[model samples]
Target: VDVMHAAFPNKVPYEIVYDRVVPSMPEKYKPLSRREFLARVMTTLLVPEEKWCLGETKLFLKAGSSLELEDLIALPDEEYGEALFKHLDLAEKKMAAAKSIILAMQAFVYRARFLRVRRGARTIQRIWKAIKLRRVWRAAAERLLEERRGRLAPKRE
Candidate 1:
């Protein structure tokens, strides 16, 4: 445990000593002192109070208790590395899925816009053709009416 503490200071649960704060207890229970708080933490970890001792600035534990604490704190490197890599792989897969969804939405919007523009162009072309046909029909009708009236009128000197 001392070696682990020396090697990996950050990994050890030393915050309790520095912070001097305990986990929340029952509302009826009074606030606990630092030593009592450390004892409570050890009890929760299945280490009896007899197995550990608290001094002015350090805590001492039996060999078995120290081993238990180390086991709880340190995971095998292989397991830790594998879990981290798996999490990253899963995140990357999710990102790819999200990107594909975004692209599909963009394609859908572009297609809808193109269809709207095409429909408007077709409507304009239809209107133009109708206007041209109406002019030609009107001119033809006027010429026919003039010829019929001339034949029906009386002869002039």
Candidate 2:
């Protein structure tokens, strides 16, 4: 309502006799009527025609149109700047939190993968060591058996 009043600085109170009779008198002609003023304001604001209706006594707006109009009214420049800065700050904080969470998850996955690979490598090393030890032991046992057999047959010589 304050916005509407501000749009029409020279608006006059509607009077039936003055409105009907004064227009016919050339000297009393008003260039813009209330309805015409409202139309011009709505057009300038780019408000959709369907969103508003001009009634005899009052202007009617569709649901949510008034809120849209209110939003169209500019805030103080300082307040607007402050609001924008606050919103940006909040968004930055949220992004930072999300980044931290993602990094932690990545670290956990990397550590788990490293441990799994290390365990597999250690198992392979243990198996290889056991195989080498068994081969060496078997070779030593065979050499000892050959020696014993030779000694047992030496008496014939």
Candidate 3:
């Protein structure tokens, strides 16, 4: 078969790359965007809707996940691209915010470890303060991560 030929020139049909997916589907299955995510997990672990007072319910249907520009061709076009653009903007904001929190956390942990090694009280206070900020951001990020993971994970059929 073509797959076997592609995977290994001399391989049998059964030896082809078995787990291969169509190049397009994986990105479509990306977890929810962080704003939608944070909104979802902020109060209850449930995904949000306008009924929940988070915001308009239309957003659920309108929001973007993690698709690349090439993938958006199949996505529904906004009447004028506004809704889709807004959703994408929100996703980008969330990704940037999440990255910032991660960087802050790395800085905090490395600094704390350095201060501990230095063994100075002033350094300890500053490190602990940084650590506290890190913990808060990390907790927020963890909740988002857990929700995304839960959504993306396979479930019993």
- RMSD to the true structure for each prediction, in A, is 17.8, 18.4, 32.0
**lDDT measured at residue 11 in model 2 versus the true structure, 0 to 100:** 28
Give candidate 1's TM-score. Answer: 0.48
Q: Is candidate 1 or candidate 3 better by TM-score?
A: 1
- Number of the top candidate by TM-score? 2
Better of 2 and 3 by TM-score: 2
Q: Candidate 2 lDDT, tens digit per residue, 16-104? A: 21233333333322566757645554554556887676656556666566553344334454443344334434655777999999999
Candidate 1 lDDT over residue span 1-157, tens digit each: 6534433222234443324222323332236565665555555455776666665545667555665556533555554334333443465577799999999999999999999999999999999999999999999899888888888977677
Instruction: Give the runs in model 2 whose Cα sits over 4 Å from its true position.
Output: 1-74, 155-157
- List residue ranges in candidate 3 displaced over 4 A: 1-80, 120-157
List, residue by residue over 1-157, the lDDT tens digit for candidate 3: 3333333222112111111212222343235543453353322222234222222221121122212221433444432134334454566678799999999999999999998887787888899999999999999999999899989998758
Candidate 1, run of 10 with poorest lDDT? 20-29
In model 1, the clashing pairs are none
Give the worst 10-residue stretch by lDDT in candidate 3. Answer: 12-21
**Order of candidates by lDDT, top first?**
1, 2, 3
Of candidate 2, the 10-residue stretch with the lowest lDDT total is 8-17
- Candidate 2 — which pairs collide? none
